[model samples]
Target: MYAELFRLDGRVALVTGGSRGIGLACAEALGEAGARIAISARSRDEGEKAVRHLAGKGIEALYLPADISSESAAQAVVKQAAAELGGLDILVNNAGIARHGDSLDVKPETWDEVINTNLTGLFWCCRAAIETMVAAGRGSIVNIGSISGYISNLPQNQVAYNASKAGVHMLTKSLAGEFAKNNIRINAVAPGYIETAMTQGGLDDPEWSKIWLGMTPLGRTGKPSEVAAAVLYLASDAASYVTGSVLTIDGGYTIH
Candidate 1:
């Protein structure tokens, strides 16, 4: 029954930013569960490499070049992936951008860039994915949020990044509420100080690491696979009744 509960044998999934870091981990995890994957990224080389990696694992992986910031591009990506993979059953909004700067020092251009990629791009992709999912009357969407959306970092500032992620949290809930009747599930995964390219800047800094570890109950950073596991659960039938939930993959940071 457990096998039947989580199996994704015939599903087609699209994971934005699937080339590396947390996104790649998720793509691999889902692929291992038997889903056909369409990995999207701005870099063609990285996208192809990711597809090769998934294929090496005996997963059907397709490379889709897309920058999720453009609404038309986002829709086109969904259409193309659906056409190539036959249909879409899951969407992981994993593409994001972060910039650290003083709230006062953050320029409008920088703020727009962060919001565009982190929040607006996510909306675009969701809209496109939802159009398809709504027609099919079933779908699952998982947005990758950040702990910064709830807690602030002291040593370095990322005002725009935090704002956009916070928006993502709200967006997830709103989308979930609106689409629940349509048999669509929307959720957000907020990760805290995970070991990934996004956190390399903070990881290399002793002061930042000290602060993060001091706040987290676990005393250590989380692995990409750990987060991927959470994503896999949320995307599977095991979580069929879960929706509008903000699943935190933090190392007990919020508990403290």
Candidate 2:
């Protein structure tokens, strides 16, 4: 039953930044696969809205609200998910912020906020989830990185975002080695120019859109569901032997 490998009947997954965009898609995918889902993010309104949407599809979902930029807040959401969901078997770190500017013109606060949310905060959530997973003797973690981590994007100067996502890729490898003994797996997905709210602005801009689509071999953007499918595969037993790897979904943008 190869398909059974992707089933998560008794698993509990905690998805950060699960209110919208790729995060929500990941939550829906995991939930549809039979995993009980708990999603956390800064916006309570959006969180509740996401939960309702999941419910409409007969998916059991909980929205745990928190601003993940703070270590305490990030850790609290992880712990809360474990307590509420009975145990945490999977963790998806999708909460990240992007601040695009020239390195010299970037505000100190802007850089701090992006790094705090995208890297440091993701690590905080992972650390807490690992603690519980270690006790449970098994777990999985899937991080949402970006193709920008591998190559700089054209027409946008997002130094902070690029650095943070690059760190995420390395961190995934580092932790994968550190925790393999505990039977915990860690991996990342590096997406390029997906059609999410976070990236829609670029797609809407004629200049940005032309360069973006032109550079991609596929000649178009990606859907959130495409990213979600990858996340679901990594989070399930389907990727049991996969760890410390970055799966790139870039529509051939990085091939060159």
Candidate 3:
């Protein structure tokens, strides 16, 4: 009975930016757990390649090419995935970008780009997914937040990225409160120093790696799979009573 709660045989899930890294891992986890999967990303090539890889794993999946930075595009992808996959039972808002720049030196457009792509775009995807979820009377939405949302990173000037993730956390809680009556659950995962293409350069940098590992209680980089496991739990019936919570998977970095 406990194991059955994690099973999602007839459910459909949509993961934005699911072509690679953490997003891909999330897609794979959901699919392996028996949920029909659909992934959306900006790169058509990467999207197709990811779909092929999922096919190889025997997880039927769909690839929707879209830039979540556009509200229309975000909404369209959700609608398209729901139309194709039968209905939207789960949504993982993982499409985002980051940049390191001193607040004083950052351009207005740079700030806007990061905020728009990371925060506003995520909200747009949620709006579309929620509409479908409300109609269906049940849903789960998980946003990919960052450990930086809880604390500032050292040796990096990423005010915009930090701010955006903080927004994601609050938004998750706010939406959860508003939609719980609709039988929709919203949550977020805050990851720390996960091994991904986005963090490869920092991980390779001797100075950055030293600071990072030294701060983490685990003293190692986390895998995308580690984060995905948490996502899988939160997206499953096992977490039926859980919502508005931001599960932190940061190797104890935030404990400091």
Candidate 4:
């Protein structure tokens, strides 16, 4: 009975930015749980590779190349995924970008890029997925947030990223309230510094790595699989009672 609680037998899940890192890990976890997977990414090479990887695991998966920063693309991706996967039972808005610099000196274009992709794009995906899920009367939407949303970082200045994630957290709660009656659950996962392609540069930097390790009580960076596990729990029936909540997977980084 406990094992059956986590099974995703007939579910279809769409994971944006699923080519690598945390997004890819989430896809793998969902697939392992028996869900048909649809992965979206901006790079065809990466997307195809992810598809192949999932196939090797005996999981049926599709790769959709899309830039979620554009509303049209976001909508199209969802449509394609639903069409190909049979239906959309779960949506993971995990696509995001970060721009670091002094808040006063950040460029307008950079700020817009960060906000558009991190917050606005996520909204578009959620909106499209929810529309379908509402009609079906059941669905789960998980947005990838950051620990930065709740606390400022010391070695990096990423005001836009932080603000965008905070927006996601609130958006998750608001949507949860609006969709609960429809049997759709909305939630966000706030992950701390994780080992991903996006954060490779920072992790390789002696100074930055030192600061991050010193600040995190775990004294080490997190892995994509760790975050993915939390996402799996939230996306599965195991978390049927969970919604409008932010699950922090930061190794106690935000405790201080």
CA lDDT of each prediction against the hidden true structure:
0.91, 0.95, 0.95, 0.94
lDDT of 4 by residue, 1-256 (tens): 9889899999999999999999999999999999999999999999999998888888778899999999999999998999887899999999999888999998899998999999999999999999999999999999999998899898999899999999999999999999999999999999999999888999999999999889999989999999999999999999999999999999899999
Per-residue lDDT tens digits for candidate 1, residues 79-191, read 89988998899999999988998889989899888998899989989998999999999999999998878877667889899999999999999999999999999998999
Lowest lDDT block of 10, candidate 3: 148-157
Query: Candidate 1 or 2, higher lDDT?
Result: 2
Of candidates 3 and 1, the better by TM-score: 3
lDDT of model number 3: 0.95
State how far residue 128 of model 4 sits from its true place (Å): 0.2
Q: Is candidate 1 or candidate 4 better by lDDT?
A: 4
Q: Which residues of candidate 4, in runs, are more than 4 Å off?
A: none
Q: Where is the poorest 10-residue window by lDDT in model 2?
A: 95-104
Q: List TM-scores for all candidates, in order.
A: 0.97, 0.99, 0.99, 0.98
Total backbone clashes of candidate 4, pairs 3 or more residues apart or in separate chains: 0
Over 1-256, each residue of candidate 2 has an lDDT whose tens digit, in order, gives 9999999999999999999999999999999999999999888899999999999999989999999999999999999999998999999999988877798999889999999999999999999999999999999999999998999889999999999999999999999999999999999999999999998888889999999999999998999999999999999999999999999999999999
Enumerate residue pairs that collide in model 3. Answer: none
**Candidate 3 to truth, TM:** 0.99
